[model samples]
Target: MSVLLVLPIVLPLLAAALAIIAYNHRTLQRIVAVGALIAVVADSVFLLLAVERDGVQSVQMGGWPAPLGITLVVDMFSALMLVISMVTVLSVLIYAIGQPGVDQDQPVFHPVYLVMTAGVALSFTTGDLFNLFVAYEITLAASYVLITLGGRREQIRSGMTYIIINLLASTLFVVGIAWVYAATGTVNMADLAVKIAQLPSGTQTALSMFLLVVFGIKAAIFPLFFWLPDSYPTARMPVTAVFAGLLTKVGVYSIIRTQTLLFPQHRPSTILLVCAGLTMVIGVLGAIAQNDMKRILSFHIVSQIGYMILGLGLFSVAGVAGTVFFIFHQIPVKTALFLATGLVEQSTGSTALSKVGGMIRRTPLVAALFLLAALSLAGIPPLSGFVGKLGIIQAGLSAGEYAIIGVSLVVSLLTLFSMIKIWNGVFLGTAEDPTLRLAASEGETRLATPLLMRGATVALVGVTLAIALFAGTLFDLSERAAQGLLDPSAYIEKVLG
Candidate 1:
């Protein structure tokens, strides 16, 4: 079981090495990347089951003791995250492989993508703050390459903004780590959970604030998300989907972990609630104002983040559980939407709402997929999004957080409106204008989307539906994860005993 925890992180690095060795052989690179992700998904599933059945799991590296040696730990939360992330990565890799020009333009894509997966895996499993920061750097470095793969002027410009912002976040993370270590005398999360409670109230609050700002920026919370709308929509489809699906969630996961484990006694719930409200309102409004599919989705990323943060801010069992379930729900829905839009872009040569229309007539499958995902994202009933939001709203109501509850409900409505805007602009109306018809015809005739791309996206759509169908079981797991987070004594014991 302990060994299984390392495989998710290690196998990807190994696959990356193999990919680099076989750089000239695209088929081999594809096989290696896909194989590695398959293995990671399997390992993550096993880890989730093992943790659920047994308990929290931990292993010390180099045979060193806890608080002194490097440590890896897995509870329901981390294991679930690992599973979803690996699954999403695999799906996106398939989508990328099927794209006509991806391999031709980016020979090193497989290796770098695998490295990024390794980084995300490492971040989820690492039991220390320093390693978490290291993991962020690893992921961010690969993202810098992936984001600017074609080196187009727009991509380079957006990548530069991404780089500068993330670099600042990284610096703050290091500073936060230093402060944590100085205040708590150890950087191990489990040990810090124990020691942090011993610190003076002022020091604890101050450290929590520092960490919050660092993660807030990473998570693209309100007022800190200026770079996301510009950066995400400029990247290629696969890159954008993966980033939307995974990257910001990592920051949200860290916030949940740290707030629950190290600072449970000193939660800054009020401030988080305020941020949550603002992030929700601001993000959705930005989405409503966007003219392009990718940019609208990008802004919604910021808005949807508010729901997760709302769960965290509520700081209760139901709230955290709702957040956990929401994370799982959002991952696939968002990724599928991105891939669906990618399909639209491939089929019509444009994601601009004004230029693309009548996609439902040309490619009903893509339009249907996008509609399902968009509806799910808008919190329609019987979908994972509705379930997650209902849980959070229920939790919020119980907690007397009426303000954020109002904000969240309004955001959901606005989210639906934005989705409708896209549906109307890109899928609904006629494209009878000669020039637009000619461009659509050329796009369909010359750049037809590959079956594999659609297949990968459909697979993600299936996952979202599965989440909805299995909502009871997944929500139970999330509740258990929230319980573990709310009371970290067992986790601390498992790591330190």
Candidate 2:
């Protein structure tokens, strides 16, 4: 089981090297990329089951003991995140494969994507603060490449902003890590948990706030989220979808891990709650103002992140459980929406609502996929999003957080309205051009979306429905994860003993 812990990170790195070596062989790159991601998914699932059955797993990198060596830890939370991240990457990779432009830029896309996958896996499992920073850098480096792959003016401009902001955030992260190590004499997370508790309250609070700011930037919390909408919408669809689905969640996960383990007794719940409310309100307002599908979804990412933070702010078992479940639900649903939008762009040469109308008449299946994913995102009933949102709201109510509850309800309504806006703008209105009445008709050469792309989008939609179907078991796993977070003694004992 401990050996399985390293496979997820190692496999992708090795695959990335292979991909670069076979850069000219596009077919081989595809096989290597998809095969590696599939292996990661399998490994992640096995780790999840193993953690559930036997408890938290840890591996020492060079066989040195903890507090002196690098460690990879896989509790329920980490394992669950790993599984979902891999699944999302795999789905997006399939979609990317069906895009010829992506293959035309094969040398850059394949290897960098694998490196990004590895980075995401490492970020979830690493037990040392420095390694977490390294994971983030690796992920961001790959993202810089992926986002600016074609060197289009908009992509390059947006990628520059993305790079500058993240570099600043990374600098802060390193400074914070250095400060922690200076204070504690150890960078190992579990060990730091014990040492941090011994520090003065003021010192601890300062450190906590510093790290929060670092991750808040990455997670795209209210004030720190300005870079996301601008940067995300300029990327190609597969790149945007992967970033939307996985990257911000990594930041949220880090916040959960650090807040739970290192500062359990001194959570900044009030601050987080305030930020959550503001993020929800501001993000949705931006979404409502957008006339483009990608921009709307990108802003919604900021809005949805607030729900997870809201759950975390509640600081209860149910709150953490809901946050975890919501992260899981949002990843697939959001990715599916982006993939559907990508299909729209490929078929209609635009994602602008004004340019791409009447998709319901031309491509009903794509419309259906987008509608299902949009409704799920808006927390419509019987979908995964609804289950996750209900849990969070109930938890907030239980905690007597009436203000946040009211805010959440308002946000959900706004989310639904934003979804409807996209629906009406993209699918409901009459086609802007009369000759483009039917999809793939001789007059509509540009409106032919590949079957493979549509299939991949449909597969992600199925994942969202499956989450709803298995909500009971998934929520139970999330609850157990939350319980572990609320009480980190078991994790500490395993990692530092």
Candidate 3:
């Protein structure tokens, strides 16, 4: 079982090397990339089952002991993250394979994509602070390549900003790690749990606030989030989709993991609640102000992140459960939405809402996919988004967090408004562009929406629907995972043993 924990991280790294070796053989590259992710997905499912049935799974690399070696562990939360992240990554790769320009001529895409997958797996499985930092560097370094893959002027411009901001966050993260390691004499997360609590109140408080800022920037929460909308909208659609789906969520996962493990609190923190509220309001407000599909969706990523953080902010079982379930809802839907928007872009040669219209006629299947995903994003009933939001709102109400709850409701409605704006502007409005009036196959050489792309999107939406249908079971798992976070004695014992 411990060896099972290493499989997810190792498989992708090995396949990435294979992909690089097959660089000139594009078919082999595709196989290596897709097959590697598929294997990861299967392994992750087994890992999740193993964790749920057994307990936290831990492994010390190179036959070394805990606190002195790289320890990788997975509880329910990290296991859930692994499963969903792999699905989203694999689905997007399929979409990219079908799209003509995405990875068609480029051999570097597959290897780099696999490297990013390995990095994400490492982030989920790492059991220590320094390894977490190393995992982040791995993920972000790959993202730097992915974001600027085409080397377009806009991509370089946006990627530079993205790179610079992430570098700042990385630097702060190092300082935070150094401070904690210096105080505790070890970076092992479970060990730090014991040592950090022994620190003086003032030191703990300072460390808590400092690391929150570091992760807040990485998670794109509130004022720290300005870089995301600017950075994501210019990338290739698959690149943007993967980034929107996985990267910020990794930061949010880190916040939940570290804050709960290293800086346990008995009650909700007002500072976190304030950040959550403002992140929601400001993000949706930014969404409403955007006319481009990519930019609008990008802002919503920041906004949706607030909901997850809000649940964590409550620092209660229900709240954390809500956060977990909302995260489950978010990963698939965000990826699906971006992919759908990509399809929309393919149909009309633009994601500008003002320029492209009447997609309902041009690409009926795509319009349906987009509408279903958009409705889910807006929290329409019985969809995964609604179930996720319901859990969060219900938990908040239970906690008597009335103000942020009100803000969340308002933000939900505003989210609907922006989705409607995209709906009306891109789907229902007149076909202002002649390109929008014709499918790529009909006459438009610059536009395309292949079946494989649509199939991949539909598969992700199915995952979203599956989440909605199985909401009760997932909520139970989330509660269990939350309980583990609130009481990590077992995790600590297992890691240190």
Candidate 4:
């Protein structure tokens, strides 16, 4: 259990070290990344199986007890998130190695990516509030570097906005932590949960609201989402994919964790509900207005986050479960689509809908993969997105939130329309150059060539189809994870005992 808890964080940290040491060697960096990804996948699988069979478990570092030493809790929810996160990282790693923008031998890129991965793993598993803060900082610092990796005028300008916004959010996070700790004497989440409700209602509410704003910024819900669209698109392809995949979801995870565990009876559902509705409406509108593929996807990320939070705001088991399920669906689909967009940009030298054209006539396989991913994003039937959206709508209707249901439905439709716009513009239009040929067939393939960037387009297309086909099994897993999160006393006792 301890091994499972630690391996996800440790694997990436060790890989980052190796990457730094092998800074000038592209092959070594790729080997380290692949090896670390394999270990992460294995660890996540082992932990997932262990939790399913034996229930929630926790491990205290250095063999010390909790409250005094750090602890990593592997509840069904955390374990499931761990698995999804690792899978996203592995996919993005393959995509990164394939993208021409990435300097695999760049001294800092691989190492920073590994650090970000480790930070995300730690953030999901940590049992203490201060530790969570530190984990978040680790992720943020790594991301700041990643957002500027290209160092282009646009990337830097966007990176500055990202850095400023996140730094402020981090400061607020610290302030909230101080208040929570001052109010309750300990920073262990389980302990805080037990103690928090005992505080005066006003105090509890204040703390809850404070944390909400802190995480709300991270989650990009409502007005707090302004930083996302401006910043995300400027990064390189794989960097954008990885950032799109994990960062906002981590924010949502924190919102879910803190709400369910520490403030189970906190009555901010109305506030959250209103925010979620607004977020979806505004985000999708932003997406519709964008011509850039990356910008459109970034806005959609904000919009989709609203759906997840709406599930959380409903404060029902099914709603929370639906959020979890959708989160699982969204991570891979979003990143894969972004990765596919990267390919389009790579081929056409642009991500703007106006600039990208005739992908089907040129790179048919890439076009197919993008279609699968985009259709899934639009929540089409028989795809994983449909399963997730159905759950949320079911939860909303059951709770009698017709307005939410209506808005969500409208959002879904508009989302489909927006996706189609991209499809028509980028895939179906006349070829941009009318002379561009496939990169792989034009040149010789080598042993070290990145597959997904080159011939692996077909393979990625297959993987996306597989995810769409296996929606049932994944939905069930997410349901179980949500149930575990809603009743975390079992998790608390197992970890602290």
TM-score of 3: 0.97
> What tens digits encode model 1's per-residue C-alpha lDDT throughout 238-268?
9999999999999999988998898978989
Candidate 1 residue pairs that clash: none
Clashes of each: 0, 0, 0, 0
RMSD of each: 1.1, 1.3, 1.5, 2.7
Candidate 2 least-lDDT 10 residues: 434-443
**Superposed Cα deviation of residue 81, candidate 2 (Å):** 0.8
lDDT of each: 0.92, 0.92, 0.90, 0.85
Please name the candidate that would achieve the greatest lDDT relative to the true structure. 2
Q: Is candidate 1 or candidate 4 better by lDDT?
A: 1
> What lDDT score is found at residue 122 in candidate 2?
98
lDDT of 4 by residue, 99-165 (tens): 7658643568888888999999999999999999999999999999999996899998989999999
Candidate 3 has its poorest 10 consecutive residues by lDDT at 432-441
What TM-score does model 2 achieve against the real structure?
0.98
Predicted candidate 3 versus true structure: per-residue lDDT over 357-391, tens digit per residue: 87787678888888888889899988988988988
Reference-based TM-score of each model = 0.98, 0.98, 0.97, 0.95
Q: Order the candidates by TM-score, highest first — what do you get?
A: 1, 2, 3, 4
Deviation from truth (RMSD, Å), model 2:
1.3
